[model samples]
Target: MALSEIPMGQIRTYGQIGKAISCQSAQAVGTAVSKNPWLILIPCHRVLPSSGHLGNYAVGEDVKCFLLRLEGLRFDNP
Candidate 1:
């Protein structure tokens, strides 16, 4: 899965994904991310901003945090 490629204890910024797939704008990646339909199955919560902020989530940040926590992902102070 594309999301699984993020690793077990790491995260990926939207801009990084955009750069990886030859996209020039992180906003484009963010738009696609917002449309993701797999929810926790695709680990969309693992995708975040480059600043280490939680960013926005259709399912709410709290829920997203819960999911990330379940995956052993920690959001540290940046």
Candidate 2:
């Protein structure tokens, strides 16, 4: 699956995944990602805001931050 292809320690934007599936908006991709039933398997944690800021996550922004930190990802202020 597309999510599985994303490597660990790497990050992707919603728009990038949207383009991969031919979706027009990153919002659309965010919707699909929010509904992903297999969170761990899909690795939605790897996705971040296009502005390089961590956005709201289904599990909460705190959790998102935790996951990103666990992966050693650093983000600059937007």
Candidate 3:
């Protein structure tokens, strides 16, 4: 349900999800995200690193970026 709210051209950090759910730890959220089997269906690619890095993806970072770009989301890493 949380994934359903991620609009196109937007993203949410693992920390944000964790914080919303009262987990208080992005690493734990990342771990749960890693277990997500739906991938693009659930839009896990919309989850970015808290530090603004692209980070890894189950389908690889290149594929992840491609999907985000396809959805018109920008990659603004520092």
**Which candidate ranks first by lDDT, i.e. highest?**
3
lDDT value for model 1: 0.80
Ten consecutive residues with minimal summed lDDT in candidate 2? Answer: 69-78
lDDT of 1 by residue, 8-71 (tens): 6578999988888889999989999999888766777889988788888888988878777877
Pairs that collide, model 3 = none
User: Please, what are the lDDT tens digits per residue for candidate 3 over residues 1-78?
Assistant: 666578878899988888778898899889888888998778888988878888778878888889988998777545
- The Cα error of candidate 1 at residue 26, in Å, is 0.2
The lDDT of each candidate is 0.80, 0.81, 0.83
Return model 2's CA RMSD, one decimal.
Answer: 1.7
**Model 3: how far is 76 from its true place, Å?**
5.9
Show where candidate 1 strays beyond 4 Å.
Answer: 76-78
lDDT preference between candidates 2 and 3, better one = 3
TM-score of each: 0.84, 0.85, 0.89
